[model samples]
Target chain A: MSEWWSVVETARRIADGEVTAFRVVEDMLVRITRVDRDLGAYLEIDGDGARTAANEIDRKRKAGEKLGPLAGVPIALKDNLVTKGIVTTAGSKILAGWVPPYEGTAVEKLRAAGAVILGKTNLDEFGMGSSTERSAFKKTKNPWDSSRVPGGSSGGSAAAVAAGLCAASLGTDTGGSIRQPAAFSGVVGIKPTYGRVSRWGVVAFASSLDQVGPLARTVGDAALILQTICGHDPRDATSLDVPVPDFSAALAAGARGLRVGLPKEYFAGELEEHVRAALDRTIAALRDQGAEIVEVSLPHTHLALPAYYIVAPAEASSNLARYDGIRYGLRVEAPDLLTQYSKTRGAGFGPEVKRRIMLGTYALRSGYYDAYYKKAQQIRTLIKRDFDAAFESCDVLLTPTTPTTAFRFGAKATPLDMYLADVFTLSCNLAGLPGMSVPCGLTPEGLPVGAQLLGKPLDEVTLLRAGAAIEAAVGLGDRRPGGFA
Target chain B: MPTLTRKEVEEIALLARLHLESDELERMQSELGVILDHFGTIAAIDATGIPAMTHAVAMDHAGPFVSLGVLRPDEPQPSLPVDEALRGTPKRDGDLIVVPAIIPGAKE
Candidate 1:
């Protein structure tokens, strides 16, 4: 099997009897065993379980039964997404031993589509930080450069797909968790418009902004997983009731005559020379393919990061209040009742979680509520307005997914420095807009760089179309990271 | 600037039911102070009369639609037993649940 055969392609091969699902699963396990030790992409690997499921899929295929798009494919789930009978810790010690009785909505969808759950990948404790360093268990290293970060809180999922450990993985994007990591890791990721994918089973970061997305080696693979997962779920009240389009079909439409708006502000300030050059090359490639590139301005782009910090943490502070060591998590021994609450939480939660809780608690506090959290929401409207106006002039927007390529581990020590990494990707989440990150090029150091495509709400087809055009133009998906097999 | 002292940090920690070590507390205090100071960037921006939007869709949940069974209609549902509910509880006095002695007036 070729290393670059996406999950969709592998499924077709299995269906055609050219290769069995067992062979694909075994091959993936062998690769993971060979590569994941150095990558730190997976927190837990379900080798035996995956093999069992794959064997079943192969049996069904031999029986001449129809299969799902992801049938017999091995896919990783972000640790935050609860999996039945698996240790679903959101990369935090707090939920270290918590095995959920029920699986998450998206995981259920994947199971319905016959996807073998490969394992759970590491993430920020409750999806907090941009760097996977915030994970209490382990830091996921970048596939391109081992010393650099793979981006987070879905860093593990991105790294797994990038390093070829898994065919594809699910990552929750709450303010760039999915897209930024995809950018840094040199893979494709899509955070569907808010509510397009159900959030019922995923651990909440910020309820309003979070969405489960796919991280894959290619945009088409990402879209295949997305089409399977994007639909209304009675379990999630906020889940969108939009029709799920055949994203893989849309990807072949190409980028001809598409009005791609390049937000001017995203190109300036903190954009590395390499990133700017790569973005320019990507835009030029699209232009050559008959795409109409226009310089459009999202005037309120600068306020996105600040507004995100306020609103996300405030919502996080509320959503995370569920984990009091009283529901499903680690429990520290203490003498008194009160002491138990204090000790369990203090010992279990990582520093980043505590920081966010504190920030959120303060933001939602009564005396200052209107001044901070409330005002941030108002600005969120203005930010959405900026995108709404820009979309009127163009079908979609284009920008660098991240300002720079992957940075070395511990490179961004301060909080704000790491927060700045999401400057480009956060607004999409804030506006409930669909967005994608596709590999554009590599830095001079050989680290990967990615360009982002933003589309109108519930218009993932446009996002996928532009992504496919760029993916074909660059042909970066077939290229593995340096020194890989 | 939002001046967060060691006392305020201690208070917030207590409210959140977190017991921090002395060094951890001090470190958090300093970090929180720096972050709170940065909030001035947002505070400096003029948002004079804009209405705050709690939800992106801005649906009124407290209205008559709630009574029409749209907003979290109450329905009796099967759940785990008392033993199962207490299974994850860190502090359980036999069948009775226990919590911290939160001083009501102290928080205010």
Candidate 2:
């Protein structure tokens, strides 16, 4: 059996001095060495760094220092987060072996709170794909079924948490990268509102859409991870200046009297039979907890995917332009400058990354800008307006995190088909709303089903409150992936 | 139903600084064409006078582009050490990063 504890439980045991921090890190490292080859969730393990951090935590405890909230909790970081001296590849060959000189604000905050980072997890190259197959390094397998892919670009982070590789993990979500994988791996993933978590030191995909959040075994663990890393950072101009509410406190408040809207647009079509059945059960359970299920309509829902494909790539092209190989990362040389740029980029980026860059470049070209880029931005406004109107009737909107569950590897061969996998979760990113995925049920075949909760912009407290209630009622925590355990 | 032509795909590859093999180029011709066709719905929408959304979250009204909330203040502060900043550079010569000549010996 595994000695892996949830985030909160691990912290409590460490804070109480019942378990040494080094011991905890060593145990997790042991488990990782044994199982990570099968799961492929981690790209690299920082065993020495983690041991040193854990030893410091233990020393602090021995010195009678007050323990921080996440004292001794083992955490995994998505490879995109800059950790000084740790390679931050963002799952792209272009950045292979590039170690960041600075730390991202989120990683910095986690260390301050006494979290020991065990390793960097794999991701879709630059977080560009809905599935982890886009990762150039390693494809992360869904913990529930090795034959199936872990939904990604945050796939490895989600898989690591679900497989008990770490107490918690942080993953950045641009369009459902965090939540979709969390859903696929049967864990809880939260993508805070666009500005809630600072993006400084995190490699950018689409600057406006990317936000770092947590994946964990439970809603409470997600809350604990969020609490440690949230708050304004001067470095990130877009970071919210607003104070973070006690997310853990929100977990205590049950779903009583909360208005949970079931958006008709989300449930109307394309849902698999098993997933719909699970979502229906989740809705009934929420209703039993006194959450009033209001049926709301987000009329412009279907337009979101197309708009996101435009907006995200357009931004990605600009954000990814920094990889000229003159400054950081892998560089390819040629006789001339332009040739060098082409050669390095051609060799560095994967097909998915290249596809986005090309599409984005095409969309933003002068003549087509008004038709493709501007028009997409306008649709973005409409999508946000749809959410604005829905929030007037309900406190939080509920939907299936994905249309189906964990899909087999190579299932979505075409780019468009893969993009459609994020259909339900994309709108929340476009609207800049706080959204989370919590495991609710499983299909008859044993694949995990994720029920998503989306709240108004900056209204995560409401979303988490409902999600916690759903989590409590379902007792989804006990439903572990069999193979890893 | 806008579709990208082969020439257009090649042109876009040049602009993106990507050198696509013939196979990849042919694939993109069909893939990008379909992607653009899907996005045609955006163009189909009536968005006259509908303001484009530039930011997902409203700005602090004091960052950049003060008209619509830009970025953090322009104030200067301490930053990374010079060595740390240069550490990731693939080709650095004692604090100076070396790059291929762009302007063709205008100021080597």
Candidate 3:
């Protein structure tokens, strides 16, 4: 099997009888078993489930039945996205071994599309922090350098794709959870416009900002997954009523004649020299390909991180109030009911989760709500307006996905330090626009850095076309990190 | 401004229902101070007259993409068995799933 065959390519080959779904599943299992020991990307592997699904797809193909578009392709899901039978921990001991009775909308979509369910990848506890180090279970190591981190809260999914544990994975981005990790792991990750994908089955970190998206080896694969999973669902009140575009078709059209905007504020900070150089090179390549590059300013960019911390945590504090050791997760034994409640919660949640919850509670409190949470919401509007104004000038905006490559484990020890790690990508979630990260070039240390492209609302097609052009120019398709067993 | 005194930090921890190590509480007090310092800047932005933009721009209507439906379904569906529903509970002793007391002001 060729490593470069995306899920779409593999499915085509399988449908034509050139390859069997079982063959692909077996190869993935071998790769996961061989490499996942060190990476710790997966919390649990559903070998039997994957194999059974592949076999069923293979049978249908042989019988001349029209299979789904992603038939027989293996995909990993972030632990936050619920599956009926598989454990959904959201990378926290508080919900350890907790399996939801209903499948999430995205999971149901994948199943309907006939994709094989490989396993659940790890993530930050309740998707709270920027680094997966906030995960209560285990830290998902960077495949590029085992000692460094794979950026998070979707770090595990990004690491899994980079390590070849799975062809692609689903991750939720609420303030750069998906794209930051994608940048650090050198993979393609897309955050659909907020509410584009239903959030019914996924565990909520911040209801307003959370979005389920795909991380893959190629932009087209991510697009294919997005097309299948996105749509309005009655269950999610915020879900958008919109048409799902044919992203693969858009990819075929390429990025010629597209006007790309470079946000000046994104490049002026302590951004690593390597990342700046890589984006400059990518911009030159896009210009050479008949695309126009223009300078755009997002004046409210500096307030994004501050606004995100307040608004997200406030919503998170409200959403996570359900986990009070009452329904699921860990419970501690104590003398009386009050002691039980206090002790159970005190013992269960990790440090970062506790920190976020407290901050959120304070922000949402009676007197402070208007000052903190409400004020942040006003700024969030300004951030969105900045994007809208930039889009008026250019069809899309470009920025470095992250400020730097993956940092060594324990690099950002303080919680506030970790929150700053998502400086570049968080604004997209706050503004509710589709954004993506594509590999541009490697750093002096040979670590990969990614350039992000932001498209108009519900304009994932434009984002994918831009990404495909960059991926094609870089020619860095399907290069797994070194030392994979 | 949120000062986040040690006493307030402890109170917030109790309210959040998460146990914090002593060192963590001390550290959080200082870190929160730094964060609140930054948040102070955002609080200063005057948005008195601007209307709130909660959701992004709505998607363009190409056709009848949204299907209107009634709220209630007359048909009933099979539900999980009581025994099976409580299978993974941490502290279920009988038909009822046991849990920590949820009464507000019951604990310190």
Candidate 4:
């Protein structure tokens, strides 16, 4: 069996009895042991649990029972997605050994679809930072370049998929967590429309902006995973009851007769040369396939970063208030309850998490609410309006995912410099639109460049169609990191 | 650019229920000031008559992605067992989570 089998093929072969699920799981476990030591992509590896689950799949197949769509597929979840019995840290010291009593809605869906849970992948503490360097345990390095960071806070999931650690992994996006990391790691990542997937039991970051999605080596694999996880759940109030169209079916629809818009504001900024070239290549590819490329304007793009900083942190501050050490996770004792709350939180959270909590608290404070929080919300309205207007003329907007490819560790010195890394990708989250990043090409240095596709709300089908086209055109076939391969 | 004072940083930290060390507080004052300064640009935009967007979904009653505020029917569903829920707590006394006294000068 090839080490780099796509999720779709892996499932098909296992279901058809061409390969035993036990053998597939064992191969992935061995590969992870060999590769993940240097990459640090996983926080936990459930070898025993995975083997037990795989054996069940094989048993069911032998019993002549119909298998689920994702039968025998090994998948990883970002640590923030709580698993019933596994330790889920969210890469924070506070929840270091905390085991959730119940699994999240998405995890439940994946298990029901017969995907074996590989284990939890590392992420920035509470999904706060753009790079996984903020993870309290260990920094996850980019698979492409050991010196560089896997774009985070979904860095582990992206890197794992890129290095073939697991077939596909789930990642959460607040601002650009999923897509940015996927871009840096040269994998396909999609942040489905905000309400597309239920967030029940997933650790909350920024309540309004957070959405769970998939990262995979191929767009079809991503679509398949997405198809399994998405649907309305009564447990999460924000989940949309809208019908989920067949995403995999839409991929074959192609880019023909589609109006692919180039948002002028996205191109107006100083993008690295390689990123610009990738964008140009994608535009040309889609045009060749009869997609009408048009220049569109999302005028409020410049304000997106600033607004996102305010809105996301503010929501994070509130959502993260549950971790006070009294109920679960790490507890730093004090003489009084109030002091205990302070001490426990301060000790449990890392620097970046503290910085965001402080910023968020200050923004929501009495006199400053109208100035910082409310004003940012108004700007968010404008940002959403920008997309609303642009979508009127286009099927999807195409742009560079990040300003540059993966950067070396410690490259972004200050907090604000690190925040700027997400400038190009923040608007999608603010507007609650579905956005995807597909590896477009490699730079002169062989670093991967990602082209982002932003679609209308609940329009992931269009994004998938366009992404599959880009992946086909830029045939960086079965690309793997040299040393790992 | 609004520079945050040391006292303001302390106050915010206290409000956030995060006990920062003296050195951490000093660092936060400088770093958060720079971020707040960057955020100052958003204040200059003319947002008169604009409604604050607390959520991303539009309030339209009719559309493909319409807002349905309907909640699930209230019913008794199976919840985690008592021991299961309390298992992860750092300090627990039987079925209850143990914590410092809420009232000042109270005995442990």
Supply the TM-score of chain A against the true chain A for every candidate structure.
Answer: 0.98, 0.99, 0.98, 0.99
**DockQ scores for all the models shown?**
0.36, 0.64, 0.41, 0.79
For model 2, residues A385-463, the per-residue Cα lDDT tens digits are 8988998999999999999999999999889899999999999998888999999878888889999999987788998
lDDT of 3 by residue, A1-485 (tens): 43346878887988888889999999999878987887899999999999999999999998999899889888999999989889989998878988777789999999999899999998889898777888888888998899999989999999988887887899999989899999999899999988789999989888878999999988888989998899879778778776787888988766689999999999888988888889888999999888999999999999899898998888888888777665567778764665666677777777777777888988877787887888888888889889889999898889999988899989997777888888998899988899999988777686888989998888888898889999988736546677662
Off by over 4 Å in 1: B58-108
Model 1, residue pairs in steric clash: none
TM-score of 1: 0.94
Ranked by DockQ from best down, the candidates are 4, 2, 3, 1
Q: How displaced is residue A294 in candidate 3, in Å?
A: 1.2
Position A216, candidate 3: lDDT: 91
* Candidate 1, RMSD to the unseen true structure: 3.4
RMSD (Cα, Å) of candidate 2? 2.0
Question: Tens digit of lDDT per residue, candidate 1, span A175-283?
Answer: 9999999999999999998778888889988998899999999888998899888887767777755578878889889889999999999986888899999998999
**DockQ-derived CAPRI band for the predicted complex in model 1:** acceptable
For model 3, the superposed segments whose C-alpha errors exceed 4 Å read: A1-4, B53-85, B100-108
Over 4 Å off, model 2: B60-76, B105-108
Model 2 agreement with the true structure over B31-64: per-residue lDDT tens digits: 8888888766777788898878878876646432
Q: How many residue-pair clashes does candidate 2 contain?
A: 2
lDDT of each: 0.84, 0.89, 0.84, 0.92
